[model samples]
Target: MSRDERGRGTLEAHRFYIGGAWVDPIGTERVTVRNPADGSVIGTAAMGNAEDADRAVAAARAAFDGWSRTGVEERLALLRRMRAAFDEAAPAIAAHLVREVGLTTMVAEGQSAMCRSHFDGIFDLLPSYPFSASDGGMVELAKEPVGVVVAITSWNAPVSQMLCKAVPAIAAGCTVVVKPSEQAPLCGMLLAQAMDKAGIPPGVFNLLNGRGGDCGRRLAEHPDVDMVSMTGSVPGGGAMAAAAAPTIKRVHQELGGKSANVILPDADMAEAVRKSVFGCMMNAGQTCAAPTRLIVPEDRFQEIAALAVAAAEALVVGPPDAPGVTYGPLSNQAQFDRVNAMLERAIAEGLPLLTGGPGRPEHLSTGFYARPTVFGPVPVESFLAQEEVFGPVLSIQTYTDEEDAIRIANATPFGLAAYVQSADPAAARRVAGRLRAGYVTINFPPWTAAAPFGGYRRSGNGKQYGVWGFEEFLETKAIVRA
Candidate 1:
């Protein structure tokens, strides 16, 4: 169970970055890191405990005062260096993601690239950002760092998630102690190395490696920690918020999503249906903002469903290294089991399966791979459409008109993101505006990092990415000097 082993698994996984140095865990306990593509144990990584969380938080608290007072220019310069470190580590990050999360190298690299793109995007906001403003020339409204931050990121996009929270927190002059998802710890380790290589001030950036029940819980419940920014399941976010509530600290949760994809009557039917399938299936449908629910015009429901089936059938699911794989297996067995369970219930309920169903893709004899499934004639009120299925499962619902389409799209309680497709620009924007999501897409456009990202209602509170993300780590202050 030694985490010190080398080769494919990063050695630092066995250790932690605390107080600006690499340190071993408080105990010999280790967590297994497995290859989802093959269901093989990659190696064991250090399993942290409450003591480790204590040490990491103490370090962050100790460094916060000085780091917070540092000039903005100094922080930006250090981030530039950190961005360079990320550049040097990008390849390793991408390579490890393939084994850690069962993503094809091409897709993993895209995830890895977010390290740079996110940092770059946030950097653009710093120069023009409004940090201080006068309130009617009577008082000065200044923004300052919120204080010690604990970032608990999900495994889906480990490095990117860390960068989105930690980078912005650091930029806002707040010290951080990050606890990456136990499901994917290597990328977080790699990012810690990047931070160290960039010569970040000790304790300004620390990484704790452990399960949510262990060190993760300690970090959330710690009194000195000013805020907890988490991205994961709704339950996980709720736990973190509850833990922090006693201390009355700020909690930002970027939780679950069962986002909708609305294909309007004016849209190209074939193209829209294809994008819906591909979009929902990407990352094995683990994305919190994925459009898992598809609402289409009822008159052409059968036609669109057939096209969706063709698209789903065309997707090749296999090992991450295998050629021509449209996507890989679920990150772990739990996710695979969860996905199949939901699918089986639908089948039992006599739901129509346009393509794929309850099992692994036929070619995927092994591994935690679920077939890329697409279902049609799904009732908008059914669990298949109502619940958040973090798998490559698409549920299609029919809509009678634009109002019905909008109604169906907003039917879900979760409103993290929604997609609208239409040939008419005005029509697309109109629908996009009506959708209750914080982030909406029109016609499968590229995901821009500069835009604000968060959800409305139960999806989660607060925002991330660009200035919105940076602001979460900051507190507003009013100085009277009139």
Candidate 2:
């Protein structure tokens, strides 16, 4: 791992990573990567234009000629090397995530662990992944690469989404050109270096750091790009689909969510409240799958509200590097403004703010800090309950019964993830099965990287981080012979 003067490890910043080479964008447009903790300019990244996207697509298309023909064993060995390279670079990347992205040390460390786990999970599944099969006496089925894949990822979970797509894309013998969110492009640069260090062939993996309107749009519409994968908001997915429609490229998307966490009457209210608080507050609630909505039985409203409000109010919000500071600043000023506006609307609508309200913390006024807001006795149909805040704020809605709880949870336009806590395992399982989300957690269970992660409804289509994730980049072709 590389170390700086402070003895903290970090990745060397590259403006762009294209065709296995670290280079600057051909265009003059650029964007600044800022430290959300203080809004300090970390570095200037090359803002890719249409031309850069064309170059990346061309590179991937060229590499597909040989890379896709490799045997499974050879591909597995190459992935193993890439995994080892990633392991050696984990510390640097983790530090960058904390310093640049402004997440708490613990949360940043956890993301790093998840990145490693994703690779391990992919490796474990590689041996068994179906590549070819004989269907009949003269017919064969082959899972072939979908050609040049253009992947766009969000700033909140940059590394996780980037690698989640990259690992599986490479493993499936597909070539990829990634357009990482300009807000968090450094992580992609480091990851590209790791791929290079692992001796992956030139042009198989390429990265362009720029605004979605520039590099991202170009990649989506590029004729050479055979498929497009994106993880962001519904608007982002729609834009990608619109761009790729003319070319008819396969488009896979995983978008925003207002996930629900229901606390059954018989569940442990205190424990459930604690986990819910942290789960929503982690990374300052920037997670797409975070349990943002807390649905509880009306009988336990007072008790649950008391615990949840106290938990939210007591959270330590400050600079990401500050010890004991669990919550960091919002990703950008735009996000800060949106959170502030939402809070204002909530207060104006008579939704009681159980704990926090608006503005930065008392002591530190420079950073973008949102108080750990909690709203109780909120109407399940209110905009605050149905919309995604994407901040440290949590909404608590009381329900009349189990059926009511399910109704409120399923009311949102998104169906990304759901959570349930019940005394009886069978009851929780039943509730879990009933939730329309792509994935649900019971009793605050741990997240597994090996499991499929995605959404249903408007949340998005396609899965990531498992065997299902691997298949997202493959196209099945059947051959028939007389």
Candidate 3:
């Protein structure tokens, strides 16, 4: 019943924005959205079914020819307008994230700003993008849109993930049908409003809200969908890949990760441990590339463990609106339950709990809040060290030597990201070079918008951001002429 700055009273989740207009969903089933901060009903959205997916796919397919033929200036103009609209709506978007996704205002603001940054980054790259090239006059190479794209984004980063997929696809002259995560569909709706305000052509950009099993599966299997781009769980990506296989459509996934942060023997133990702890606790440890596994020297295990425990205890966990709260609740009851179950399993297996464990903070009685937890002297092969908890949980493991550190860092099926800390910059870079991950940080590099990001191995394939991201939606065709 709350009203936004624009006087809109809660998002009408019962509607889906397709072909530049808000339309009612064919399905009568609705999903009641709840605020994890206090478990209050924030809103409700129509749970789209397979038929809605079909209609969206059909709209995108129909728009492909015209959108793909749009001149660069025209596309750039549209993107500029979209970015401006997004900036104007930033406060509302951030509010939605804070309410629906349990993000603190500070974190939510940064995430909301990232939506504009995605468009701005692409805006800077578009003019210089080599869409067509000539090779010695005999052969010409043309980069063209891949056609209708279905973008499936994750709940942890709904706004950024959606923009990351949709902006690049649109910039590459492809029509897109975006399916935002059901857990945080409101952010997607706000972004769609921005797009509508930007005057994007009908059918060029579409939005649908629904569960992955029904709408997502249908979109992946649809013959009209030229490519499937997803940022979600590994099982979800695998399902999309399998469903898209029958039609042999291109599939790009940014899936899960159990990333490692290695603190070399030469590093400042206290500083390294503190930074790693804070990094793991960011976003309530819901980030896919979070350094959840801390690989430290065996001799310094006690010192590292103590520092980690102190760091975890220092984090202020409370509701999103609480004064000076550094972290908030898990986005939903399911995640809260999952984190508690993992903690229980760890305790049962006799893993040492360094700081917090197995419950909500003592102050809060009813919410999805989980204590910032730390575990130490954990074996590299232990469940605590090998899995993506996606909570404010940290697992500290010991390594005998530098070689051992690298091996332990690469031990998991995931290779999304890795971190190396050392007083010697050269040493840190050396270890970074050996990591199998797509992205690595040596003592933490400055965040850059143009840095290509994705993963290696089971972490998922393809790259995003800057030129690489823009190219993901494009196909190369070579023409020979004499």
Candidate 4:
């Protein structure tokens, strides 16, 4: 379809950005970006082959020598400019994310908030890094840049993940090669433009538009790339780390999650159920850190389950750009189908559907839409409860008491994030400490940018954002005097 015919301008398919310029994809084929709202083609974007990934990697290697050696002050100044550029372009970026990814404006705003916050937080922590240190009359240690970095980000919160890796890597004086998810690559291209406007040197921050299997694989496996950081599926993260292993490059991954919300018996059932549904169902539950499983008191099962169902029923799922929209369409068809299958399996397994079950909303039949699903008394071993659905599905399981709640919350193999809602702050803190996860939101506290974010166990390793994030791009060397 032509741009004029569609009324939104012709979307170009197959354009890759390398060394500050947009070029045609090296591959012959292209991928289409579909609006989940109606399953209509929004535009076509580039899908780079393995060969194209190599070319991007070569360009990144060539630029890294100069960019990595540049002084910290120079890099910081450039990032400051980039931050300003982002501020000026905030509205456009936010709008693009909403239209392309089918996220509510509030969620888009959250992505913007994360992007701006990461940019500002990393800069704040840069001055504190131990770039050079001394102990007595001898040199103690020095943290040096690790050269070229390949950062692969997921589509759920495109800008948020990109900034999580890119901002800190830049702050540590490392040149970056970003491979954004094909599902939402336009945002990456726009970010490249912002970097250029910020006066960043060519090749300093290169963006490649391509699929994960081909372009992303090559980038992860390239020998010239010195380090890799990715945020996506656990399998994807493992593959990237394995690809980087032969070259001995540092691999930092933040992957899949099925976080638990442990609602203590002492906690208010109304408040706990409210936050659990909203948190898990936010972004259509596409977030890696979303608390999808709720572990509540078994005795209070009926009470909390009813409240959760009410919350889900109250949610207004519609087009992202629509007024008063609470939830948006799933990112793609695959996610939509997966959610439906899981719901069906839950029903078949005898789990009672507290609120929404499956299928598209009756009103909007075209786009990927799954009713907000909530299940109570679900078996912990069920795929719907164990696996990461990455959809607007919440599984409610009841527990005996605080001890049982923590046990259920800690049952998941993925430990990315956890949540606890309690009337008593001390009790919440005590529970938070015991949960084996990277982050815990007590009473849904404001997500802080300066806080360190990563995962434990199968969730993947290495921190992102703040000082810990910046350090991932640096290699610490110790010197001892005779």
Candidate number with greatest TM-score: 3
What is the clash count for each candidate, in the order shown?
A: 0, 0, 0, 4
Weakest ten-residue segment in model 4 by summed lDDT: 1-10
Candidate 4, residues 1-482, lDDT tens digits: the string is 23332124445645666777777777876777877887676678767889888877777777788887778688779889999988877777787777678898899888888888887886777766668888878678888888889999998888878878888887777888898988787777767766778877877787878888878888888888889999899988888888788888888989999998888777778877887898999889999999899988888888888898999988889998888988999988777888888888778888887778888877776788778988878777777778998998888888877787788888878999999888888999999999999988888888887688888988999988778888889998889888
Q: Decide which is better by TM-score, 1 or 4.
A: 1
TM-score of each: 0.96, 0.96, 0.98, 0.96
Query: For model 4, what is the alpha-carbon lDDT of residue 141?
Result: 89
Q: Candidate 2 deviates by what RMSD? A: 2.0
Tens-digit lDDT track of model 3 for 11-36: 55678889888999987788888889
- Measured over all alpha carbons after superposition, the RMSD of each candidate to the real structure, in angstroms, is 2.0, 2.0, 1.4, 2.2
Question: What ranges in model 4 sit over 4 Å off?
Answer: 1-8
- Output the better candidate (2/3) by lDDT: 3
- Who is ahead in TM-score, 1 or 3? 3
Candidates ranked by TM-score, best first? 3, 1, 2, 4
lDDT of each: 0.87, 0.85, 0.89, 0.83
